[model samples]
Target: MISVVILGAGNVATHLFRGFSLAENVSVTQWYSRNLTTVEQYKNEVDITDDLSDLKVADVYIIAVSDDAVAKLSSKLEFENRMVVHTSGSVGIYDLDKKHNRGVFYPLQSFTKGAAMDFANVPICIETVDKKSYPLLKTLAKNLGSPVQKVNSDQRRVLHLAAVFVNNFTNQLYRIGHEITESEGAEFDMLKPLIVETAKKIEDLSPYRAQTGPAKRHDKKTIKKHLKQLDDNNHHKAVYELLTKSIQKTHGRKKL
Candidate 1:
């Protein structure tokens, strides 16, 4: 079995702990958090500690902390020359302290505390400096039924950027849609099916081909109406105008 020690108490760390705990081929040897109260509940299931000096030997040490804390935490580890990996999308593998073998086990998905997550559906992007560590990481990912993809630092950074557009930015757009619907006393729930279908469309068609709506069709009248509807909310107006112009530009149409 692949043994692991997970560090941090954030959303990503929590989800990773849940995924690992359910994996028959994986054993969570220990869990560490600077704030003992955050992970204290799991003490009965696995060793939980706030002291780095109290850490036990494990096949892998996963630093699932924030990006800014990764380096400092790695530097603080009392052991060296062992496989250590971080769960970060944008941080490079070299960000880890040079004392140990460095790698990344980035699960490319938006994580929220207490949200249900199936690692089987999450794509795990991995990068490793030590060749020997790749297979181990890959096996760990597969054990959770995740699709493993080998990506370098640059590729991972680009993926993270695209992810922000698809996940974060898209969610913001949904919030705008919610506000707009609520303004008219319309239920945002009505748009659920459309959102599901829009997502499913890309499964077979490329985003370019799946594109639809006024911006893609260059329906100036409809576009102008949308901008007018957002006139009361300048913040939402600017977002709408910017996205409309972007879609037009992508389709080789003149700026709206």
Candidate 2:
């Protein structure tokens, strides 16, 4: 069994620790957070503490903190020359303190507080300077049932940017849709099926091929009507016009 010490108490850290707890081949030796309250619940299962001096010996140390804090926090680790990894999609492996064997264990997925996600579906992007360190990471990821990918820093950063566009930015659009429907006194749930099918459709086809609606059709009448309806909200009108023009450009249609 591989022994791991996780340092962080945010959504990603908590989710990963939970995944490790369920895996038979992994042992979570310790967990830490700057604030004790964040990790107090796990005290019975693992050594949960805020004190960095109390860190126990482990095969791997996973630093799952915010991007800016990663370097400073890892530098503060009194332990040295141990295998250390961070759980960030955008941050490169070299950002960690140089005293230890550094790498990345980036889980490419959105994490919500206290929400359970299937590890098997999570694609873990691993990067390491030493080739020998790969199999250990592969083993740990596989034990959690995660599909592993060997991603370099450049590719990982771009991948993270793409993820934000698809996940975070897309969710904001969903919220806008909800607000629009609510203003019309209609139930937002009415769009749920459309949302689900839109996602599922992309699974089998490229988004370019799956593109639809008045913008793609270049129907000036419908476009004008939609813009007129959104006139009360200048922000909504601006976004609508911008996306419509983008779609027209993408589909090789001249703007109306």
lDDT of 1 by residue, 1-256 (tens): 9999999999999999999999999999999999999998888998999999999899999999989999999999999999999999898899999999999999999999978999888999999998878999999999889999999999999999999999999999899899999998999999999999999999999999999999999998998888888789999989988888888889998767
Number of clashing residue pairs in every model? 0, 0
- Which 10 consecutive residues of model 2 have the lowest summed lDDT? 247-256
Off by over 4 Å in 2: 254-256
Question: Relative to the unseen true structure, what is the C-alpha lDDT of residue 244 in candidate 2, on a scale of 0 to 100?
Answer: 87
Residue lDDT tens for model 2, 1-256: 9999999999999999999999999999999899999888888888888999999999999999999999998899998888999999888788898998999999999999767799988999999988899999999999999999999999999999999999998998898898899898999998999999999999999999999999999999999999999989998888888888889999998685
Q: How much lDDT does candidate 2 score?
A: 0.93
The residue pairs that clash in candidate 1, if any, are none
lDDT score of residue 49 within candidate 2: 85
Regions of model 1 farther than 4 Å from truth: none
